[model samples]
Target: MAPPQASSIPGRLLKALQSINSSAPRLIASPTAVGSNANPGASRRASVAIIIRLRPEDSPPGGNAASPTSSAAASASTSPFAQALPLPGSPTVAAAAAATSEVSASDKAAYPPAQKDVKQQLERFFEQDWVKRPGTTAEILFIKRATRATDKWSGHVAYPGGRHEPDDEDSRYTAMRETWEEVGLDLAEDDYLSVGALDDREITTSLGKRLLMILSPHVFLYTSPETPVPELQESEVASAHWIPIDLLTAPAARYDSVSVDISTRLAPKNAFARAALKLLVGGMQFKCILLPNEPIATGALPSPQAVVPNAPLKLWGLTLGMTLDLLSSMSLPTDAAASKGSTKSGDLSTYPHAVAALPQDKGALFAPSMASIFPRFSYPDINALIWIFGFRYRRTLKQSPTDSARVNWAGMSIGSYYAAVRRALVVAVVLRALTALGGLGWLGWTLRKRLQSRRTARALAL
Candidate 1:
């Protein structure tokens, strides 16, 4: 066969075989890099290298494959990488899928997420029991009418608050200021349990100016077996009550109502409280009560210019709304059976009775006396009365040009003082009116004088 002509074919094969055998047995062709000599199969595997690289585009794609000899250069020109990756059943694909699933499962279990906004944060805060609890103890305060021993609005539903002072720092201070001044309760620093603040309003006061009343209404509960006893201060408040928060918020219990001047209505706690009351009939959920509706400047009455007729007492306005809001916001379970089983009030008792059941450490539960916290009024009469001074000191005072001066100079403080002054002023005005009618005729003047004297006597007495 003349050397079989196979030598030509075998010559090239022999050279490749020599290269694989002589070298460290590279599994790759050309054998430019390190290879394994430890394994004899490495040489045997060298022949298969050509088969693995049969696709010229088997190399990675990129500028890094700029070299013409680089396998990636040829691979970059074609879609070889996609072809190399085995589908579904490949070990490499299976391992990667397993890893991804494991990671996803871990992440799903480890991290969730939440909501953060001012309104949302506040709403969340109000849902707490301490925030929601009907404050069993509360006080009401008002300034005494001029020359009167009693307050301008006696026996009225009111907030235990006063104007904000420099020390009060905020509206909470106003509430605390009035609380301290009106009642002798000494609430502690940590005693404050704030819910949410009500809207702000300009209050046209009977005492004076259009004061900016920034009311920070709060709900604080005091639980005890015994009723909460409030130390009364005759100067600031004649009385204090610890009524149920439920009652105050109850639509049925709301007794006072006028034409919807400048008030908002709070929805009734249930369908029952809402259907019964009429004056609280605005359909909204809040109402406004003016503290002393006299002129701001004159601090006197009978001036249309002084009355901001529709100006809501923003401070108390919001407070009232919040009080009702807090109560109605609670959602009792609709299923009677479910609610009965879950209900906790059955075993619960008042503060003293529940001492064993309640939390042990209730940091501070009382506020300071109003006299201790509130600044003394600047005027001599107001200041003297605030300090509980006797009439002797007031009797020594001099007269001024106005009738107010005469009343202030009189030995009177409290509700009786105002009554006396009001009677005297009304009598004088009526006497002038009678003179215009017929100059105080015997019958008219005698009857008027008797009535006037009786009213004056009543006003002067304590």
Candidate 2:
């Protein structure tokens, strides 16, 4: 089907953002006790900004326009946002440069407070003449990281962010500081407003077998009349693009799979052992979105030479996880559709309205996502089988779609969505190991028999 109505997205997004209730949190990366002394700003936590902005129509929408900000410098005053605090510091050339590991009291209060009535402020923001024009598609910013020899995320499609610096007052400050340092866009400025926070994600390694760090994805809404022109940092960023939310939710965006080298995921560090693992598991098939390089605003290299024009941009892994959380936050569920008759006419109305603007990956997830915390072996089809079994098992058990499964980022732990898949994984591994042992045992027995026969002069041979 064609992409969802673009103009209505802001309205839907506003509702989605306003509806977010932080009292009850979703299970992110891994669980941290609600009342525990665990700090979100711990050294392991890193932050990324999911910045959403309106590419305002060049003209005005006289009919739907809302009242304008009264300040003489409309874009200079305090902007409104989610109840959660936005980074509070006045940014200058020095602050952005130093990015010291410490945030002082003055540093924390550097920027103005964001308007807290998200519902009201956002409704007004979207109603502005420029934003209400026809075909006003919302866009999210994404950056390609500059390739570095030691950077694990080198040359990857990711949001702008970095780890919490010792000087950062909180996780939000780290995201703000990094965004400024990496892309030259300051979150503290009036040009943007905070959209609030997403669930904390626990980044992991070895197929979620080890906790690498905690990831906080902070969403922001751009309120400017003009498209954000980022001054790309040649050292940290390769190119910056404004991807329309419409393209992200389109059917074709998620139709393909990415081949990942997961052989090293759970293998020992020894070169021989890793190579042996690769031999056993040729490659892994995981989900990915074919992100277009359209509307590339700026880059380190000239547009043509900046990105391999021919090769498609692939988005997966931790970045994909954060993207999924953002999409989930934007959706509100609908009544499960059903048709009850011999005619068997399926009712399309039962399909989720919430998913209209969201990519629908066929999985046990309540919303579309990359599907697994672990990669699937394409040749052995171990991962694919897990998904298939999980789907069928859930159906057999008569589980509700609203209660679709969730995943843990920290390690191999999973929610109900992968319940059957987990069992299938154990069964498959055990059977494969047993088969290998049985073959080796039979070979050993045959070799012993031949050796014995040779030692004793066979009657016929004499």
Candidate 3:
């Protein structure tokens, strides 16, 4: 009677255990954390950032700390698996050659100043290892711009970053500041963690003309359990999307070519513009990634006109290039041939039906005559000739030392004008040569006929 029943004690103990479990803090993995079943240092989540390094010559000093000579030496002392992996177009061979010729510290001190300078220059040239350029590693954020008549990039999907401001200390700050301003997501906040940066890419026109501005892509991680909802600044962003890292690998995501109208933007008379126009007018084919059901946080825009209700967002051009870089950095094979037997979950066939379908236009881009001539002859050859002679012609046309004073007839460079004239001259010369040959043949025929008639007359007189 004094002691409690055994069944009652067990129930009490179970209640106590439940209370303890409820009070305990749940352990959340860091964005960079690797799964227990995954290969060491391999990340299972798409939130992780991969820092891609460039060759020494191509990159600024201190970009990467590992020296090629030291790497080679370390590899020589270790097993085959420990040896540096051979990368496409890597400078390992050159590094090894330079390493072999390297002098000890004592030998360098003994050398004269002139000799030391020469050796240092030589070392600088050969010391850097050239590896196959690494792909981009960051899960970059892209923003769909609001449709505005004044904005050149209106309705285009682009990164959240913008031009550097005087208030920004550097490009990293510009990216972060822009992120906060446009998306209402403060990258500097506690929930977000800064990752490394990708190499700076030069911004260019759609036709491949270089621009003055350069872009630096930075990666970040969101540590919170819940996905942060982006508050879009309607003036800039129409909608913001968090594209899955694996979305690009989907089968249905592939679009061989999609037509984009860019004629209005390009100079119609420019040779480069002409070539691009020819390819794009009928719809230029491009490697594209489609995101149909990706999470999109809509902002202040008209209902029907805002976002494609349920259509897939097509990513192409520079955006597509950046996506490829991200995949390449992950060491994931991207080629159609290599991706076929892959064991990734990115196969769109396994996902729901695509809400938006890309137009199927896989037919030949060029006419039969144009297609046949393109391989053996094309605009590129003509452009090359213009480039070489155009400058000289421009110099000749200069009336004064100043470029403005120089005559720019027809709103084009003297090179272009001369190129057109040269082509006309060639055609004219060909026609004249043909006419002269025809006249000579007629005269010869007339003489031969006269001789035959005289021979017949002589025979009749006999």
Candidate 4:
């Protein structure tokens, strides 16, 4: 199926933001919004900036390509993309007009229009000549953190953010400060407008029982597409990527699993331990999406554009949770239940097909990510056992979505309520350990039998 036109993105996005206030449960998460009570043992607050911009088709940052703000001369000239829009008499517009025309004037008068209810303006926005002028694609900024021994999220694909600092005035400032320090974007400047904040999130250790920090994701839009290229800070950031929205929504771009090394967290100090653990565990599976690394230049950091491997980057863990919320807002109205159950908030009615295009899990309960869930082993039996254990836990969360659980993504809760998910991992590890010991015992028995036979042969010969 054809992807949704990038032309319609701005309207849909605006519509989604407009509905945040009316949501039944009030999932308005602002970066500056006062921090709510912390979860037990979770005192830290962190914020990330989700910076979005429109990448005009085939136009460079400073390219002379025509823009929405360009002279009237450009709009007067015909553009190729304009032809595909629903023209006045076309069936789509006609159907829409027919639908709205049927709405009685009395009914229209009784209920004032909201951004969500103004389907006609949204339609008109799409119909504008400039919108269809082979215009821009929406893209969000992401950064690959430099490998740091101290950072647990080192080398992970993430939005720009850091833990709230004492000098910072609020969580929003933490995001703004870290963004300028890590990437070169000055979000506080006039070039960007703060759209709104996503619902707050919880950072937790694996098993989802422990709380680390509360995460607030703030959204910002570029006032102009000609915003300057990002300058990477070498000490914290390696490269910056502007990921296209189309890729994020594509069902094909979603992967069922990613391979994570088991030794990174468990056996960092001893090579022998690492090798033994890896030999047994190999690589475990987690939910992930494929992302290409297109790194931009960095003047702030000397030769700071770190060389990325040819492999596509994986988007999982807490970052994935934030992304899922962004994707859900695309279909927020269709599911008011989301507003009530979700801690988050999207306007995807402009493109119905992409709404709820939530990435699905194949075998594991990869409901976005809370903390890094322990991965399932390569052994199918072990994985099946793990899933079976999590079955009740997953079912409970599914039923009680509005239970104030701190972890949710794509309309699903993950951590804090995933004790069973963690317990399953512990069970799998114990089983693997027993199986390894059983195999060693059989090998030892076989060798002892062979040695006895060899001695018998020598004695017979004597």
Candidate 5:
């Protein structure tokens, strides 16, 4: 009789599934032969443990949220006790937790209440700066860690800004609203030179709170040439300070090596050190080492290779990453300009004696460089190169698709490597099964034991 036909949908499905399963590596043994392995009991136990770990624990009998674990585990999960717990996707949290569980274990310890009050207090403080002059420096308030509310990210410093309120008509309105709410500054449009929308980022507060702060930092220029007074807002903004541009530009003002050095002559050494240290630390630390002052003319702003206005200052974590991204962006050409110029090199080997046969000034063949495009651009090529090296590197400089073909080849290689590894694993399992079934070692051991006993008996008889 002919084999049964798989005409029905179920039968067809079964056949298809069998074919697919045959080609795939086996993950489970058939139930009928499950116990027919060298270590069936051990394997079964491992499988059961894996399944249990994957299942969500049943809720507690009470009205309260279901408890994942009971007894000591519940108490140990408290913020203070849980500080050392690993947070998902956190590179530092794991190492930090292991190094010092005491500081990170509990929710309260990891993010205390003090951190919460600072954001609220600082927000209120910046609201009072609205009527103030432009061109003056301002310190954006940040939350401290010890008094933070949640474990998500506690005790981190950040700008005081929130979602647009009903009264805010536009981004400018929202900026002012946040400024009023967070810091006591009441800023006006004229006070702000430019308002730019930066890349949106999600941030977690120290109190375990998550928020999407669309950073639209208003470049407020002090209109008042006179000394400006900062009004501190309650709960939101705790305090404010006027930071000088020179302080940021000076080599003596950074925790790391400065890009440029300021001319210091005829300044008092002790006074210069104190000022420089203050500029470097800026509430980051209690004290820092700094260079001594030469004179009033000695401490000048060091001219950097490139200086972009409103360049982001990276502090920590996501904020730091975002800040770096912004700084990097200052160097990248827009999509339009990136498309300019031919990437091809002319055949120079045919005319080795002629310099003209070499790769033409391809830059001129398309659009001029950003520096030449904007003659007013003050930065030199060296400074621009340093500032935007990352952007330049990331750029797809090739005009033709063939330049990126190597990436495709690399991807194929990776896939081949993965397939090879899978096949090797399957072969290893099959070899192990064959070795176990043959029992060659066990048979050899029995024969050797019998021979040794017989030899001992013969020796005694002799």
Candidate 6:
């Protein structure tokens, strides 16, 4: 028989494939996919919205919790972590007194005795560990995460929030639910007034890849005169504190030269290898703020060594950015110029002078408006190549000559050298073309002159 027609074979194969496909199970979409289809905006919803309450002028300062006669004393005495000390004559008290005496002597030697004012401040911090009500400023709430070896954010300072759950009506509800779950501060809409929301910022990996989570910070003011203390939810939150907004605005709050490790691989033990690795994967530097300290639970151990003590609660990264946004919304200066002359060494005494001396020329300090916190650049995609090449050239020129690895041709950096060589080649090409054109013009002139002379000679001969 003749070979089976290819068309007939394809039809048979197609029929068999169709039958198999019809029997196959249909793929189901995930909950997230379904949710996105139902509400497209849910994908852009913020994972967290931290509340910022404006503290009243009469509110107690941070250390007011430590004073027995202070308004915070009532709350402090009722805290679950608070306990009565042993009687003075008891064996427990005597032994503890002796141990304290020994430690005090050693501490005095290691650290000079604080000045009278400083000593008073330290005493206040010990007495009142929580933010007290009736204050002249605003207080920003922060949460210390529960320690877990497996979690990347374990034991880190963060605002109370979590990923959006299906049960939540929206992101705001998600924030409220998480806050209540994490800190047991039942924040109902009637309990607090909504101040506003900050811009949404994307969460990213160490290498800057976008994650599914986004942060939307929502500010709120407690309606009641007194600031309520938060009950800790030990599973997710170790402690929560309300930090005074004034302290945050103070110049002493800012700390520079804070180094952050961003290496993806384990740091090399060898010195040379470590240096090479550092060059390959550089660390990020940030301006961090020291947040007010929270009262440590009785018998609780100190925080992890990685936790920087620049502030009682260190605020950095996205939290700091959001804090700045909050400040800007209040018409307060968010730029470093506001903190001018307010060096890390400056104390609270300098606040009045610094505030009074704020630079008259606000334009010199930062962008004229809060909306311009970060400058925006608009350019067409068609010019992207040119812009990128120009940027590379400028960056190369700014690099140190000692960084030989960055240097390409001779002493010039790669980009600059490449651009220079390209320019030279272009110039040479243009010169060559001009010279050829000049030669042709000269030849044409000579030929015309010779022909004229020949014509004249021929005419004379005739």
Instruction: Give each model's clash number.
Output: 32, 14, 6, 3, 80, 16
Ten residues in sequence with the least summed lDDT for candidate 2: 345-354
- TM, every model: 0.27, 0.68, 0.42, 0.63, 0.28, 0.47
> Candidate 4: which pairs clash?
329-346, 330-346, 330-348
Q: Judging by TM-score, tell me the better candidate of 2 and 4.
A: 2
| Deviation in Å, model 6, residue 361 alpha carbon | 12
lDDT of each: 0.27, 0.54, 0.39, 0.53, 0.27, 0.42
Cα lDDT of model 3 overall? 0.39
Misplaced by over 4 Å in model 1 are 1-155, 189-212, 223-226, 249-319, 331-462
- Candidate achieving the largest lDDT: 2
TM-score of 5: 0.28
lDDT of 5 at 213: 28
Instruction: Rate residue 317 of model 1 by lDDT.
Output: 30
For residue 328, give model 1's deviation from the true position in Å: 4.3
Return the number of clashes found in candidate 1. 32
lDDT of 6 by residue, 1-462 (tens): 222122221122222222211221111111232443564234434445466554445565442342112223223344322332211110011221132232222111212211243223222322232223223344567877777776667766688877655545444455666676565555554555433333344454442332444455544445454666665556666666777655554322433334565333235356665564444434434445566666422112335775555346666655665565454333322344454543432221121112221233422232111111111112122123233444544454355322324312111332242353245334544655687799999999999999999999999999
Question: In candidate 4, what are the lDDT values of residues 221-305, reduced to their tens digit?
Answer: 6646463566556667766777776666533355546567766656779999888767655666666667776555332232345
Better TM-score candidate (3, 5): 3
**Looking at model 5, which ten-residue stretch has the lowest summed lDDT?**
46-55
Over 168-262, each residue of candidate 3 has an lDDT whose tens digit, in order, gives 43444556656666666656565554433433343445433323334545555443333455666677776666554434433224433345544
Off by over 4 Å in 6: 1-46, 54-59, 62-135, 250-252, 265-276, 296-311, 332-462
| RMSD list, candidates in order | 40.4, 10.3, 25.0, 13.9, 29.4, 28.2
Task: Report the lDDT of model 3 for residue 158.
Answer: 70
